[model samples]
Every structure is written in C-alpha cells, then in structure tokens.
Target chain A: MAVDTKKCVGCADCVVACQTENNVPHGFCRDWIVENVKGTYPSLDMKFQSERCNQCENAPCVRCCPTGASHIVEGGIVLVTHDDCIGCGACVEACPYDARYIHPQGYVDKCTFCIQRVDKGQNPACVDVCPTYCLHFGDLDDPNSDVSKALKNRSWYVLAPEAGTEPQLYYLR
Target chain B: MKEELMVSGKHIAEIYPVLHLWHWEISLYLFLGGLAGGILFFAAYFFIIGKEKEMSTTVKWATFIAPLALMIGLSSLLYDLHHKLYFWRLFTTVRFTSPMSWGAWTLLIIFPLSIIWVASFMKDMFPNWNWKWKYLNQFESFVIKYRLPFAWILMFLSIILAVYTGILLSAFNARPLWNVSILGPLFLVSGFSTGLATSMWLSKNDAERRILSRIDIFFILTELFLIIHLFMGFMAGTAVKLEAFRLFMGGSFTISFWIFVVLLGLIFPVTLEILELNGYHVPKWVPPLLILFGGLMFRFVMVDAGQITRFLY
Candidate 1:
C-alpha cells in the first residue's frame, strides 16, 4: 500500500470505512490518521498520513507466535487464525507497529489489508473510501502496478525503518 | 528547531499494550516459576553430589514446595490467558524460536518431574507410609533406582526453566527495555539466589543456613553485575534503548527498580546475610524474606516498565 501524504487531509473517512467493513469492535480501529507538523509557526509544514498494519516481510508477530496462529498468507498479508490463537498476547507485544490487539472473542486481531476483499479482486475498504484518492493499493511486485508506479515517481519512506521489519506500507512524500 | 506532532483516530485501548496484555499475572508467574526452578535445581544438585542426606531441607523439604509453586505459577498463566479452554493448543506444536513455546514445553516436563521427585523421597520422609497398590510400590522403587539420572535431568531443566523466564521477556525486540541479552543470566542468578534464600530460611541447621547464605550473597552480587551491564548496554545502544534505560534511571520506575528491587531486595539482604555469616546475630527470617520480596518486586518492575518502553512513542 502507498499513501500520498500531500493529498491526505486527515479526514478519517478511510478509518470509518475500514471499521464498518471489517466489523471492528466499537472504540477500536484497524486504520488511523496521523498529522505531523514541522518548523516554526510562520513556516510550518504539515502532513496527514493514514496508517495501519505494514504487512511486514519479516513480521515479528508471526515469528513470536507460539501456537502458529499468526502467519503470513498469500500476497504477504499477515493474518491470525482465530481458533489457533491462544491469545497470550505475545504477538501483540512483538509487533513494532503496535498493530495487533486481543479481540474480545479471545484472539489477536489486526489489519489484513482487507484480504477478504482483495481475494475477491477488490481494493481494501480504506483504499476505496479514501476521499483524496491518496491511499493506493496494488502489487508492488509488478513493475506496472499502481503502487510500484507511485513509489517510482515519488520519494517515500516507511515508519520506523530502523526496526528492520521491512514494512510494505509506503508514504509518498 | 522545535516541531509539533499530533495523532488522531488511534483510540484503541490495547494500544497501551502493557496495560492490557502483560500485568501482575505475568510478573507473579515469572517469580513463582523462577522460584520453583531454583528449588528444583538445588534439590537435584545436592542429590547428585550425595549431599541429600546432609542438606535435608534443600533436597527433601524444599522439593515438596517445587510442584506447588509451579502449579500456582502455571495457574496464574492460565488465568491470564484470554482463551483459557484452548490452552492445550500450546502443547500441540513446538516452535523453538518462540520463547513462550519453549516455556510451555519446559513446564510440561518439569511439573510432573517435580511431583515425582517428591514422591521418590516419600519412603525416606515417612518410614512407614506405604502405597495402597502394588504397582504404585513398584513405580516408586523404579524411580528411586534411577534417581541419579532424574537428578541430572532435573538440574538441566531447572537451569533452562530459570533462564527461560527471563528470555521470554527479552525476546521481544519491540520492547526496548527487555531487549537485552543480559536478562537471561540476570534472571537465572536472581532465581538461584531466591531459591537459596528459601532453602536457607527453611533449614533448621545452622551450618546449612550459613552455607546457603554465603552462596546467595554471591548470586546476588552476580545479579547486580548483570543488572549493571544491562543498563550499560542500553545506555550505549540506540536512541530508543537509551530512552528505555532512562525509564529505570530517573523515570517513573526509578523508585521501584532502585529502592525496592536493588536496595531493599538485594543490598539489604546481602548485608544481613553477611553479618549472619560473620557470627553477628541477625533475625533468622529477615534476610531470606527480603530476598524473596526483592525477587518478586524485580519481576513486577521489569514487566511493568518494559511495557511502557516501546520502540515507538
């Protein structure tokens, strides 16, 4: 996934859309918005970014899960098998992004990039509902894919690059 | 230049991961598990060295407490588990890379062995107690016959169990406070010290208490060394790790970590034990009780402070 920081307005339509589509429990969210402001008041530079699970290539959640409940699925989407999860909260603590939480039903839950929709050949709900058209989702492996093209045209960065998670989510500056 | 940042829509309560996930249950479990491991290790060590008859408290009486501590510790872990009924899943698979898996499997082996270790000494502890069934009698004899091998296995497993408790927390790289390599050894030495303190407290023999107290002082010093190294490593590490070091240095956890865990828990006990060893009269119960208190407080502080010290703000 690629997010264009300049285009985002911190409106949080994507956050609501994701919660509604995923049936995320009340007061919890699979996606959120961050606003960063830099410089003095007269020359302030601000940016709004939508964030969620990075779908890390070297995901710590999968590595630390004792019961193998948290695993990576097709397209590198990290997922948790509800029944297999013992809900010991190891994955929740292991995640550098703090992207996971124990569900009220006793399992770890996180953003799967809306894999159910993606498997059906649709964009994630957050991507589809983004009003500024800033949230871009596509196959980075394909050279002509929208995500690849977006990254190719803009200088981008991932959150906590020092963490070595190899996070797939990109913010286009 | 100063910069301002604001985040919105991130209202997940579990976002405060430590507050929602690991709490007193984990800390208590870690303490009891370490205590059990320490007790079993000393028991097996003395039995293997032919000192079982001389150190009756270390080898026999303390062995009785091992299984109970483990059961309570494991019960706390079970109570903390969100999916209590599905806990058997921990045994269905083994992931060597995962510390929790290692811990689960280790406990599976140690728990039964602890009970059997106690059972093997039943005839010695009670001269006239007999098993109702003939097969039970035969099982006891078999266990006693190969008791040497059991002692060796118990010793090995106890070390692993003691160290595993610390490694479980240190394995989480996301939490900078717990990401140090020294944690495993630190916890091991601390566990052994607490184990010795317990044995010392229960022993009626003056010689046994002096020996155990001396050994405990060494373990406490080793633990202090490891703790110093842990902080030194963190201070020399990346920015996030330095922030983690600061949590115990002068941050919210300073009093708990320094005063409770260091001064009262380790220093005070060490001083008391040393005085006792030097023919100075000190209350028999004070040092050991303080050591145990310090051990418990150490786990509580580490677990609580570790949760607050994350890689990300």
Candidate 2:
C-alpha cells in the first residue's frame, strides 16, 4: 500500500475502515495518522501520514511471535490469527510504527489489508472507504499495478525502514 | 538563550536522549525481574522436592517478597515517563518492533501469572487469614492439583521474563552496551543464581540448602559461558558502542563488574558449590550471600555506567 500525502486530507477514514474490518477493539488502534504538526502561530504544515502494518519483507513481528500467530502469508500480507495467539503482545510492541494493537480479546491485531476480502478478490475495506484515494493497495511485484506504478514515480518513505521491517506500505511525500 | 532553548531548535532530536533512558529502565527491570525470578525459582525447587520443612520460614518470605519487590521495581519504570497513561498504552498495543512493547506485554502477562502461581504456596503461609470463606478450606486441594503445572509455568515465565528483559536491551541497534545476543542467556543464568542465593539465605533447612547449593553449581557454570560471550560480543561491537566494554574494563564501573558480578556472582558461588559437591558442605552463608550480592552489583554497575554514555549522535 502506498499513501499519497497530497491526496490525504487527514480524514482518517482509512484508519476506521482497517479497525472495523479487522475487528480492532476500542482503545486499540491498528492504524494511525502521525500528525506531524510543524510551525507555530501561522505557517503550519500539519502532515498526516497514514501508518499501519507495513507487512514488511523483513518483518520483526513474525520473528518475535512465540506462537507463530503472526506471520507473512502470500500476497505480501503480514497476517495474525487471534485464535492461535496467547495475547503475548510481542507483535504489538515489535512494530516500530506502532501499527499493531492488543485487541480486547487479548491478541495482537493489525491491518491485514482486509485479507479476507482480498482473498475473495475484493479490494481492501480501507482502500475502498478512503475518501481522498490516498491509500493505494496492489501488487508491488507487478510493475504495472497501481501501487508499483505510483511507487515508481513518487518520492516515498516507510516508517522505521532502518529497523529491518521492510514494510510493504510506503508514503508518497 | 532561554527562548532559543524553549523553542524547537535542534534540541528535539538532541534532548536528554530518551532512548538511552528507555534502555536503562529496561536494563534495571531485567536485573530486578531476573533477581525476582531467580529467587522464586529457588523456592519452587524446594517445593518440587518436598523439602518444605527443610526450608525455613525465610524461604516463604523470599518467595513472597521478591515478586512483590519486583512488582514495585518494575512499576518505578512507568513513573519515569512524561505521561503515565502512555505507559499503560503499552499494554493496549503489541508492536514487535519495540522490545519495550514486548517487555510490557510479557511483564503484564507474566506478572499476574506469577502472582497466581506464587499465591498457591502463599495462601497456606497465611494461616491467620479469615477462615470464613467456604473455599478457604479446599485451598489445599486446589493448590495440590495445580501446583506442579503452575510451578512449571512460573519457571517458564521466570526464564522468559528474565532473559527477554536482557533481549529487550540488546534488541536496540543504537546502544552498544545492550546489543549482545548473549545478554538473554546470561541474564537467565544470573537470575537463577540470584534466586537460589535469596532462597538459601531465607531458608532454614540444612537439607534444602544442600540441594539449592547443588543447583547453584549448575547455573553458575552456565553463567560463566554467558558472561564470556557477552564480553566477546561487546569487544566485537563498533567502537562507539564498545563503550559498554570500556565501562566494565577501563571506567569506574570496572570494579563492580569484576568483583561483584564476576567474582561474587559467578566465580565464588561456583567455588562454594564445588566444595559442597566434593567433601565438605560449605558454610551455609557462603553461596547465597555471594549470589545475591553479585546480582545486585551487576545491576548497580549497569545503571551507573549507562548513565555515563557519551553518544556520538
């Protein structure tokens, strides 16, 4: 998923969509908009970056999970199965972007990119609900996919990329 | 000057180095939990072998006090924050990228689990409690049925909490003092030694002391390897990070690391454990004092040396 800051209006509808689709409990958020507020008094640049489970290529959540509840499935999605989790919350703490959360049911919950829908060949609920069309989801491996194309042309950065998470999600500045 | 400092100068990135403070908090938690886990494991050993009578009334205190102390010590960490509510936020999220998150999750999980596990042995210790409750009488049966499994869990969490606390520090890429992989294993060993010593000192049973001393030997040998490995890793780290080693070797912390953590924590206890194994049962005070003192010293030096960091950032 690639986020276009130019397109995002800080609506945070995508965050709500990810939460609702993933059954993220109240008080725990799987996605966040880092409102980088700059400048005081007048010339303010409040940059809202939508952050979630990056589904990193070198995902630490996968490595630190004791129960194997957190792992990267096919389609470049880092998915978590709550039923299998003991709610150790290692995945929540391991995400550098603070994307994962301990759901009320006592398990690590995060953005699956609506894997259930994507598995059925439907778009992610977040991408669908997004008003500004900032959140782009598609195959990065396929050069022609919207994610791939936009990423190729845009100036982008992933949160804590140096942490070796290799998050699939990136932001277009 | 005050206005410049108050504004968002370059100071945001250079402010008091919050990450280092986080690491220091984690390291202190490691030491405290490690000691708590160690001492609890010692008490569990006595229970497993049914050396209850051999254990003095002190062992019970050791069991009860250590975890309570650990709970208190671990709590001190949250107050060091700008907002205490944010610390509780740790439990609300599970980010695997931050060891603090992992530590928070693990501590929350293990803390209660340990409390329950230890409660079984404790309820009986508190005979003066109101016997009015119907289930109070059957507490014995409740404990008997689940004691072993709970004890096992206590040990498992003990190891996980102790070792992972070390792993928590080492997980960071920036701090050289904590980046060693051996820290996890070493901490477990140190924790066990510390626990055994605490149990032994609190225990009044000569026979229980004998058994604990034997176990001490086993953990002592393992700790030596882990300490060596930790040093080797520190030596191999980048020059900037290698300050961890210098703190132990060339700095003021050298004496504490060498005398207390090494001699008292590792060597002396092992030496005493060996004597008991050979012909003579070493003096009752010998091993336990060494272990406890050593463990505390390790923590003290770490806390002191870490504050001396001069990061090249």
Candidate 3:
C-alpha cells in the first residue's frame, strides 16, 4: 500500500477503531507501528512503518498447516477457521514475520484484513477509519486496480521475500 | 540470564531463525532410533550366547519391538519430507557414504529382519494359525531356521543405524556445535548403556544382570570419554568453532548438561548399576529410567544448545 508517512500523525485512531470492530484484545494488536528512533538529543529521526499480516500469496503458514486450518482463501487472503484449528501452533512457529498469534481460545489467529467486510461491498474497518487514508487493498491481478498501479509506479519491498511467502502487503518508499 | 534458565527459543534463544516445526515423525524417529539401539544391544547379547530359551522374552520383545519402533519412526519421517512420493528414492539410490542414505537402506533391511527374527522365535510360542499360506509359511519357517547368520548381520546394522543418527546431526558442518568427530562414539556409548538398562529391566537371572551391568559400566566409561573428547576437540578448535563450548560453559545448557545428562543420566545410573553389580539392593526399573532419561536429555540439550550457539553468529 502507498503509505504516505508524511500524512500519518501516528495518532492510532486506526488501532482503537480496529479493536472495537474486530473484538481484538487490548495489549495485543492486529496492526502495529514500528518506530526506529535514531540519534542523540541534538539530532533525531523517528522513522515509522505500520506493520501487520502480509497475507501472502505463497504462504508458509498455509503450507505448514497439516489440517489446512490456517489457509488462503480464493482472494489470496490468509484465513483461519477456528473450528478446524487443533492449536498445534505450527503456523505460529512457521511464520518468519511472526504475524500469527496463539489466540486466547487456543488457535492460530492473525489479521484477517476484515475478510467478512471485504467479501461484502464494505472496506476493512482499519481502511475505512484511517484518518490519513494510508491503507489500500485491491485486486492485484487487475493491473488497473490502485494497488497494482502503485506496484507498477513505486519502489516497494515485501517482508522476508526470501521465505517464498510472496506476501501481498507492500510498502512504497 | 537466570542460572536455571536454559536456551528456550525456536531452535535457539535471543534470536529469530528460520525453523521447521518438529513433526511427530521426527520425534518418533528420535524415540524409535534410540529404541533400536537399545534392542540391538540385547539381540547381540542373545545371538552371541547362542540360545533362545536362555534369553528372556525381552529379547524376542526387543527383536519385534525394534522394528515396530522403526516402522512408526520411519512413517513419521516419511510424513515430514517435502516430497513424500520420492521416499522410495531413499533406497533406489543407496549412497553408502551418506548416513541418511545408509539409514534408509538399513531401515528397509532392519524392518523385515526384525519381523523375521521375532516370528522365527514366535512360531512355536504363538499358537499355529488355522489359516495356512500354502507353501509360503513352510518356506518362511525354513528361512527363519537358517536366518541365524543374517540375524547377526542385521543386529550389527541396526546398532549402526541407531548410533548414526547422532553422526547425521554432527555432519552439519554449518552447525559447529554438533560437528564433532566424537559424535559416533558418544551416540554408541548412550545406545549401549540404554540397551543394557532396557534388558536389565525385562530380563531375569543373575547371569543377565552380571553381563549387562559389565556392558553398562563399559558403556558409561566410554560415553564419558567421548564427551570429554568432543569438548576437547571444540576447545582446541578455532574460537568460531568453539562458540558451542562457550555456550556449554556459560550459556543456558550448562546445568542441563552437567546435571540432567551427567549426574542423572550417567553418574546416578552408573552408581545404581554398580550397586546392583556389587549385590546392593537396586530395583530393575531404576537403571532404565535413569538411562532413558539421560539419553533423551542429552539429545534435547545437544540439539537446543547446538542450535542456540549457531544463532550466536
């Protein structure tokens, strides 16, 4: 997604909005901002990159799950079925990004990208509520789509691509 | 770091390295491979003595149980592979130099031999089946009767498979902590000791105790010697290679290795074994528990400590 950091105030309205919408816990977060603080008192640069599940096209978590509990949907969205989960934590351990969590109910859990809402006509809770309009999701297969357009134009990187996970999330620098 | 605290990370502590979830297959393999070593020790004892009735059902049990363990173990390993269909390739091309290849071929041989050996002794023990397999059953009996020489060959091979697993882990030169010349001896020591303990538990009679306890002592001394040799090699090797020793001396596994592996697995077991040998009252079960505990703890400590040390770089 084209996250114009100059526009993000780091206010975390998206965080609160997301928790209430998805019933996410307080201490743990579906999404987070990593700030690399540099320099002494005289000089400083607070570089920020908001992070969450990459929802890979070629996901290790999906391949590792023997029961197919943690899997990829038709939209290439990484999805987990709570009922089928054996709480083996194989997916959690396999993820290089450490995106998966052992939910309180004892199953692999991660950012769904609001699969239910995105399945319908509505955008994801975080995407809809972001004050900066920084979050973007669209059909990568359709080059005309905004995400694919950004991909064509911008210099971007995916997390741990060496893993062959082919994460869908992208950062435009 | 707490003194009691050990390296407890994903293959390593204080780092994030790529790791595969240890499948049930691997776990079962470790257990089964170890069991094969234990059983083979007894098989050798039985064969050299040259009597079926002389040895307890434990020999027979160990004969049959060894393969059962291998089958379960191999199944798990088969399940863990990236390409399960190509497992036949393990045997189709046997590289004698590669321990893994040797292991696969050995499993192919060991499994059938174990069953045959057990069935040979079991033919009269178990009631004859009402259903007959035509000429095959008589041929099977004939093969079993003449299978004594092959049984010895299988025994030696099975023992090698058990110990070779340790060598397999040690072969990873990138993993310097495990890369030691003494690995083969170390594994052999533990395998023999565990085997003696296992037989001691199920077998009866003074002669069995006397012979196994002697073998047990020999193994304990040999194992201790190998551990020292492995440490000396690491210490004398380059500092980069000796990163594992630093971990051994100062890192998390210092206690687990010194205490669980050394004290409980070796010293206590050896002490009890000696007492039993000297005619002091010692339960048959005590030695097995200590020996088994030591072998398993050694694997755990070795695996965890080795991985963590590799991550330090």
User: In DockQ terms, which candidate is top?
Assistant: 1
**TM-score of chain A for the candidates in order shown:** 0.97, 0.92, 0.89
Model 3: lDDT equals: 0.67
Question: What docking class should model 2 receive?
Answer: incorrect
RMSD per prediction, one decimal?
1.2, 10.1, 9.3
A56-98: candidate 2 lDDT, tens digit per residue: 8887777766545677887778887665565544454445554
Question: After superposing candidate 3, which stretches have Cα over 4 Å from the reference?
Answer: A1-173, B1-15, B18-28, B49-51, B127-131, B311-313
Q: lDDT by residue for model 3 over A22-49, one digit each (tens)?
A: 8875445666665455556546555455
lDDT of 2 by residue, B1-313 (tens): 1111111111111112222223345446666788777766656665676755666443466777666857876776754443334344455557666555676676777677656555656556777655466785486467669877766766666677777656764564334465557767777788777777777777676676677778778888888877787778778876655877788887778877888788877797788778776778577777777777787777666544643443331
**Stretches > 4 Å off in candidate 2:** A1-173, B1-28, B45-61, B122-129, B135-141, B237-243, B272-283, B303-313
iRMSD values, candidates in order: 1.6, 11.3, 12.2
Angstrom error at residue B284, model 2: 3.9
Q: For candidate 1 chain B, which ten residues in a row score worst on lDDT?
A: B12-21
lDDT of 1 by residue, A1-173 (tens): 99999899999999999889999998778888887887897999988989899999999888889999889887888999888999899988888878887788888888989898999989999999988899889998999988999999999999887878899999998
In model 3 chain B, which range of ten residues has the least summed lDDT? B1-10
Per-prediction TM-score: 0.98, 0.58, 0.60
Error of 3 at B303 (Å): 2.1
- Pick by TM-score: which candidate is best? 1
Assess the local accuracy of residue B261 in candidate 2 as a C-alpha lDDT between 0 and 100.
82
User: Who is ahead in DockQ, 1 or 2?
Assistant: 1
